[model samples]
Target: MPPPNALQLLQSIFGYEQFRGRQADIVSHVANGGDALVLMPTGGGKSLCYQIPALMRDGCAVVVSPLIALMQDQVEGLHQLGIDAAFLNSTQTLDETRDVERRFMSGSLKLLYVAPERLLTPRFMGLMESGPVSLFAIDEAHCVSQWGHDFRPEYIGLSVLHERFPTVPRIALTATADALTRAEIVKRLALENAAEFVSSFDRPNIRYRIVEKDNARKQLLDFIEREHDGDVGIVYCLSRKRVEDTAQFLCDNGITALPYHAGLSSDVRARNQTRFLREDGIVMVATIAFGMGIDKPDVRFVAHIDLPKSLEGYYQETGRAGRDGLPSNAWLAYGLNDVMQLKEMIENGQAPEAQKQVERQKLSAMLGLAETVACRRQTILAYFGETSAPCGNCDNCLSPPKTWDATEAARKALSCVFRTGQRFGAGHIIDVLLGKRTDKVEMHLHDQVSTFGIGKDMPEAAWRSVLRQLLAGGYLQTEPEFGGLQLTDLARPLLRGELSVQLRGLPEKKRERAERGQKRSAASLDIAPADDALWQALRSKRRALADAQAVPAYLIFSDATLKAMLDAKPATLAEMAHISGVGAQKLERYGLEFLDVLHAS
Candidate 1:
């Protein structure tokens, strides 16, 4: 018999009837021995672009990944599909690694995952030479770019795959990259001639919301209680202490939360991560160190209490939510302190001056996204060089923010900065603006300046908003030494009456209440009231099975797959085979168990 084609293999092995967006084209290209550089969004079926091709081709495909947990998860999922896959990482002992190597040499495995660090070792290179390697897949390909959010020094050496095996088809894939990073990836990966497939960077299912931080912890609690109670989510904090504190705060408030960070013991981190993946409704509050290769599909929300340093980092982190294409939220609460803290970190870092400039630019872009009054989706897409219509799903579109002509206020703010000799920070400047006779004002003698008490008309919050926008708009900059606010050349125009400013007004209380009313929790969005019991039953069975196997519940079947079963109500094993995620292997393993639940219901 002839080998199965891409579409046939997709259905029989992966159980998806059709390819999404550009998967078919990519699969055919790579299967025919063409190099490809694919830029796709998270949860956009990027795996199938190479997985199907690996099965279609002649020999084992070598996958270079950065994270060991990611490799283990993917290999486990593949094993459930009856595919011969394995990984060689530090977690494996000598015997286990040798077993995988033996399988690779014998051509019994279809795909072998190894970290970039190990893939470049001389021994591993000789092992590759002894086998009929079909292709090379570099996952998280953006790490090759120095400017990328997750820069892995080892990824830069992956270009040797092309140099050594010029005839082998190589594919590089990443979920987030701007034009500059894309160019750098091409240059660093030696994929100049590879076929580039860039998908739309829009995740319409995620409703973006950014609010000015007012009691950030309280705001986070309110958000969870109001829209996402009993849901699985990820909360990101910039510091390990904050991660621990926030997780405890949520737990104290009756939420099931766990803390994960680099500071935790390796055993503790691994245990927390395993619980997060295997259990339901677990909120993992972590630092950036925790989320690179998490494959959970039912994450309903991603919250950020502290501001991310760059828009790329923010996008990649938020993309973790709604992997099943369900309604989710990317909620952020940021304030002036976040901005100052991030700025100070960047300035005080040991990076070179040129790199520091790039960091500053990226931070400015992130601030723009947070402070913009336009559709958040549109702004994000535009940053990625893709034009999109207003999605009408983000906070700005749902309740357009009020903007006021702060031209006079901006000039006054700038004058205060200049009059203070550009030696004071926002707090002192604000104190001077409000005419507060604080000790700092008395020490600085700022109470004698002409602009000291001229801004008492506006509230302190409004004045802070103006300064933040000015910093975001390039009218003001922070000094690297003292983090003091200083007027920029752009401020000359505003100070000279050549430019006008319109700052976002404070969020209205009525609008906030209305937005809350409009948003339905993840529980109420897709499942009907009548099917809630059945849905819970199906999920419970999945959880029990996953627990038995010591794998993530989604590995057994994704939430999307479970929902499909709920909708189809398949009553027999044969009918269960027709479900989207139920391939032949899964039908044999899990079909009857699920059918029993459906029949009982």
Candidate 2:
């Protein structure tokens, strides 16, 4: 077996003649006998850091991935590229694993993707020792840091790759990493001499927007109607219940939506994800659990109904959109409570003080991003030690937010907290502000407080903005366990009239990109081509087939099928296979019928 030229491999496998950003340079560095640490954003083509070198170098390259399914998907995708790539993990049966090892021994395998746990096993290690190794690749290398979102114990053991194959150049890659996580990857991987390539973290394709979460579902509906316009997107919720409820709500509102989380059965998760990839205009309402290796490139938007734990997590989740190098959106719906709830959870956890402090700093940076009045892209880039000017595309840039004097409002809110004993949440406190005769306020005599009815001039939403800004700006803290608003030492200065506060008003949630005269790309959100006839036909066919099989419509031809039919204008059964959703069994069952109806209409 002979190795392919790097340029040919890149063109044949990835469908690109030239590399993006630092990809070619990173590839050359690894091919020229150098170890590398690549900090590329999601969709930055980090896979090619070692993939190209693996094809050009002699022997095999092993990619140590954190997720088993991610490993499997990479291998399968490589196979799609007509390359010899295999994975070894718990998914493989004893016989299958042995057969893969046989291929490895024969030098027929150019690339092997393995879960860290499986790769470190005695049997796997012994087999690897018998074969010649060219390079070692680590994916999600941030997991080596305890502070990362998806930390795995097995990642720490990956250092053994250096001890076992000391001569092999290793490349570590991650989509999200701060100074702390970056240091951890270098130290844990023992890549003291690795060439570090930190690409620009700014995702210029994604327009970032944050809206306050009052009547969250309504806000989400308005956002979806304006931005979505029948496109594929992901909605990230904090809870499984929210995931299910939001998915159902979207479906009820005439959306082809589905839910994904750890709560669903593995079979159901795989089926839903498969549908998302194949279908156009499919909306996946999922917890953080769903998206890791989902390769869908045309996601028009990534919306979050709750605050993410960290900026890295937020960036990775939002990066899921616009991977195809097209303009997309990152819409976030959250409030002061979302910020506090997350901070409270971590503050109460029994982790190491240093680790908790580091995570808190990361969360704080994310909070700053949410509250930033400058370009959203600049805020995200600054977090990664990258310099960026205002992108002039985000909600802030389009509207040019104006700040207001929040000193009086801040003082009143702080005074209300002090008078109410700091036991109540934001709602009850808001109730007190409007002089509402709510029983809870009367029961606590909160109506008697001077601060009550003092905020009558400002709208409740404005007061909420002030409170959120105060908390975000570190003037207050929420008890990590109790999660009640509490005045911080910093609040004392404002409350005592010693300091005035300033705040940027919340953006009008009702106003979308189009409403503000900020035109979206002509091809808004890699979307399903407009052909209602084909869509209705494919859907009808799917429903009828699903009824006959007594399975979900997704189990039949996915939403992807109709979109593909509309896109490719498939005229025959042979062309149906070109659509991702119509598998062999499905093609045999419904292919002819689809083409006949498509042609007749």
Top model number, lDDT: 1
Per-candidate TM-score against the hidden true structure: 0.98, 0.85
lDDT minimum window of 10 residues, candidate 1: 517-526
Give the alpha carbon lDDT tens digit for every residue of 223-242 in model 2: 77866778789999999999
Output the TM-score of candidate 1. 0.98
- Give per-residue lDDT, candidate 2, residue 59: 80
Off by over 4 Å in 2: 1-4, 508-601
lDDT of 1 at 491: 97
Tens-digit lDDT string for candidate 1 (1-601): 6656999999988998898899999999999999999999887878888899999998899998887867888899999999999999999999999999999999999999999999999999999988979999999999998888889899999989989999999999999998889999999999999999999888888999999988888999999999898989999999999999999999999999999999999889988988888888999999999888778889999999999999999999999998888788999999887887788889889999988888988999999999999999999998899999999889899889989999999999999999999978999999999999999899878899998889999899888888888988889888889999888999998899997888999988988987887876432457888999999999999989998998889999998899999999998887888899999999999999999999989
N/CA/C clash count, model 1: 0
Q: Which stretches of candidate 1 lie over 4 Å from their true place?
A: 521-524
Clashes per candidate (backbone, < 3 Å) = 0, 3
Best by TM-score: 1
